[model samples]
Target: MSLTREDVAGIARYARIALSDDELTEMTAYLNDAVALLEPIREYDLEGVEPTFHPIGSLVNVMAADDAAADERALPLGIALENAPSRVGRSFRVPSILGDEGGAR
Candidate 1:
């Protein structure tokens, strides 16, 4: 389905995007081309083919094993708080979000 300028404009408005006349024209052509490319796939016969999650067979877990015994070095607290600008007794001190009386505004 070829998209008109009005269709592209409506899509832009719905998406909260500002498009110039040239941009609208370009987008209309681009959308029409994309629809034309997808037309063949949409009309293809897949009567007996089963739906698959992955296109190329089952996927293998590529992540590293979560074994705690693999590493033993613990992170030091001083090193972690070294970059903090404002700290009070081993904790970060941030500006109070409440009012001067420490009550919710």
Candidate 2:
């Protein structure tokens, strides 16, 4: 089913999208074409065919244990802070944008 201007406006309002006239025209054509394409899929015969859950041939992924540490000999805080352009008592210093020029209130 081809979408009308009123249909597009209603859809946009439901989706909270503020579409312009040009954008609405493009979206209308796109939505109508999508509807046209899906109409043929509904006509497909799937009475005996089993439903396919996965389009790609792959097994369900099981995550590995998080106990394994990826990196050995992690750098110390002092060593890491040495590379920074600025520093506080024990942390890196950064420019402030609010009430005070200082950080962490």
Candidate 3:
């Protein structure tokens, strides 16, 4: 299926993104390329091939007897914070990335 400018606009609106004219043009090209790339897959022969939902086989967990267990020792919160290079009070302090630092975007 071909992608139209209206489709691109609707996607941007749903994503809450405000795309400029240049960005819209780029997105249109990208969407077209993506659709074109799928054309080859549509032409592949699959009459005898079994459909696989996963490339790697699905994991089947073996049933095990459930038993009430004793409590286990856990690491202290203070020790966890100590491992971090930066911390404020009891929380880990990550570097600011908002426009204040022009990095969030």
What candidate 1 gets wrong by more than 4 Å, as runs, is 14-16, 60-105
Worst 10 residues of 3 by lDDT: 65-74
Per-residue alpha-carbon lDDT of model 1 for 22-103, expressed as tens digits?
9998999999988898877788799999888778787775875678566555456787678999887788777767658775
Candidate models: Cα lDDT each:
0.82, 0.84, 0.80
Pairs clashing within candidate 2 = none
Better of 1 and 3 by lDDT: 1
Kindly report which residue stretches of model 2 are placed more than 4 angstroms away from their true locations once superposed. 13-16, 64-105
Tens-digit lDDT track of model 2 for 18-102? 9999999999998998889788779988889887788865778787566546545567789988899899888987767574755
Better of 1 and 3 by TM-score: 3
Pick by lDDT: which candidate is best?
2
Clashes of 1: 0
Q: What is the lDDT of residue 14 in candidate 3?
A: 100
Cα-based RMSD of the predictions, in order? Answer: 8.9, 9.3, 8.1
User: Which model, 2 or 3, shows the larger lDDT?
Assistant: 2
